[model samples]
Target: MTQIAALRVKKPDAPSSAGLLASLRGVSKAYATPAGSFMALQNIDLDIASGRFIAIVGKSGSGKTTLANLLTGIDSATSGSIRIGGVALEQKSEEELTAWRGRNVGVVFQFFQLLPTLTVVENVMLPMDFCRIGQTRDRRPRAMSLLAQLGIAEQADKLPSDLSGGQQQRAAIARALANDPQILVADEPTGNLDSHTTLEVMELFRSLTREGRTVVMVTHERDLGAFFTETVELADGQIVAIHNGEARP
Candidate 1:
């Protein structure tokens, strides 16, 4: 096994073998253009099992990001239903969805979105502040602990600009984990990384699954497919195939 930092957060009770962490039924998304409505997703159904590393892969304009947005409650669907951890997303108002997402989902982006003015530890603590998850004094300690878990404790006092790309990304991941969300939704997380760093980050994400967290990532990198437990392929706003990721030796 690769040497990846372990996540020691208190995990929820493990679900049954057949448990579904997220589900979508008849989901579709469309945006209005000058010509007409451009459909991004069309009548999609998906079930994401708990503790799985799921990859959504497809060419550009395949609705990969749109699907990721729907899963994270960052965007609403035009039609159909989405449930994550048994909470209906479509029914929630924008305010409700924001609160629900803060507690239930953590989103990772391609670029490290850390605030340049804040130290790495402060960046990690921001989510706790926004969500009011812990005491003010306790937040920094928890942030430091999360940074340590990600093997970036020494960088906690430094601003994101002072860290390397990999270190910055690690800080971002630590920040995402601050609230202990059930699911981590990453949109092309490795897009800005070099190949070596990408592999390291992918392994770190894989380890999160072992700690009983589901990870849903959107990527077009087929070479990195081996790290995912399952792959959902889409094309022309529709699911083309679903299959197990290739096993790595």
Candidate 2:
């Protein structure tokens, strides 16, 4: 218990009785597959507080990414409710969801989804353009600042292919933060990085929490559980446990 205590971050206090930053109540997701309807998630209930770093851990086909997608509005739930920052996802149209996602959610992909043709800074600015955030002239400076904060300012002008995997991932993270969203969802964010880079990215996420940003990450690496304030473990599309830090049951 002492070891686990040391590993976990000192998260911000829970919200004052009002509600959570995000809530999933009786959520289930199923996809139409050749083998009938495939259930990716079943009866998921989760509450994410603002300024908390949460790790969703599970093996392949454990519904980790599916949960992330649902939170980010990339995919809708088959049956149930998902509300983030007081906005109910089920009530929004696809077009409305897209616009809301641009301003409210930041998504980091596993494979560093930076555009190959655009420079790192340009890639970061793409989100701002799509969301129409701030003046066009201010977007470049904001992108550069984000890259600088990620310690990759020097790589800002380079193409994604020119950067290393870690650098590219940093740029992708910069792009994710382009709109300064309150919630950041990462799906297998460090799946392609080396151990050192993985730790670096994890620490970066911790720092974000310090700034009052909520981070939900889907990762299979239970060994990195120390960096999270909470852990949600899933198996065969069902949440088996949700506990604080390394206290698995």
Instruction: Give the per-residue Cα lDDT of candidate 1 at 71.
Output: 89
RMSD of every prediction? 5.5, 5.4
lDDT of each: 0.83, 0.82
lDDT of 1 by residue, 166-238 (tens): 8999999988888888788899999999999998899999878887776788898878867877777889999
lDDT of 2 by residue, 78-195 (tens): 9999987789999999999999999888899999988889999999999999999999999999999889989999998888999988899889888988887867889989999999
Lowest summed-lDDT stretch of 10 residues in model 1? 1-10
Report the CA-based lDDT of candidate 1 relative to the real structure.
0.83
Total backbone collisions for each predicted model: 0, 0
